[model samples]
Target: MTKPRTILVLGGARSGKSRHAQALAEAMTPEGCFIATAQAWDDEMRDRIARHQADRDERWTTVEAPLALADAIAEHSRSDRVLLVDCLTLWLTNMLLGEADLAAAGDALVAALEDAPCPVVLVSNEVGFGIVPDNALARRFRDAQGTLNQRLARVCDATDLVVAGLPLRLSGEK
Candidate 1:
């Protein structure tokens, strides 16, 4: 059996990681599934979500899975398809604020990636490059997200960091 290809894209906000991931998926697969991990809890976020939705063409099938990302991957991944997760930061935020176990969720997600029958592309924000927050929750969130990104990168077949809209391939690219 052929090994499934997995790519992890990391960057700061508006660093073009999502767009880059989308392009990679579109180029690599005939059918693609976009697993959106964002939940619009406010008007600003709602507009941001809408803009992202509007940016894509109708060729992509989208699944709004705010927390159950592993299940979404297992359900949608196929041998001939590509699964692109738009953002993991929101998912992490949801997990952290809801008191879900980040380590458990990360393990589940990694396991799903290992068993997935299709190519998978994951996008996440790089949160550790900024100044340290002054509160406990903020510090914990930053730490968790950074750890999550590092874990995913280790398991991914390819990893890229986006800086100022430019992609710097860090590992597993020929």
Candidate 2:
């Protein structure tokens, strides 16, 4: 059986999205690299990062790309390596906080995934379902996140939504 070239997994926090993405990447191939986009800003974040790293075994190559996701994806993606980008929302947060160009970075990410030589799995949060935030920055983030998710989903070969630890195929078959 053939595997999907690109997949986008969307869910909330603790919704098993990253776990599911990691499993999918592991199943696709033995040589897998996890591209983490999170930055450890505090002790709690460092602990969280460590916990996520502990989940991986020896077969995983972990790369930390807190800002340059497109460059990391382009550099690591190859025929023998399956790429997994865990949590695009965090990358977006990083971009926003760093005052980077969100639109250009998002476009570059889309292009990188489109041209990847290996299969790619992207994980992101679905942050548009709840009540709107009262602050401007929060609202901007929600809007940008929704736009990015929709954009990535359009180009991906498959899209899934994890609800309560259950993955429901939103586009292609699992």
Best by TM-score: 2
Q: How many backbone clashes does candidate 1 have?
A: 0
Mind giving the per-residue lDDT tens digits that candidate 1 earns over 17-123?
88888877887787788899999899999998888888876878899999999999999988888999989999999989889999999999999999998899999
Would you give me the overall lDDT of model 2?
0.91
Off by over 4 Å in 2: none
Write down the worst ten-residue block by lDDT for model 1.
1-10
Q: lDDT at 172 for candidate 1?
A: 81
Backbone clashes in model 2, listed as residue pairs: none
lDDT of model 1 at position 31:
78
For candidate 1, report its TM-score: 0.95
> Residue 97's C-alpha lDDT in candidate 2?
87
Where model 1 places Cα greater than 4 Å from the true spot, the runs are 1-4
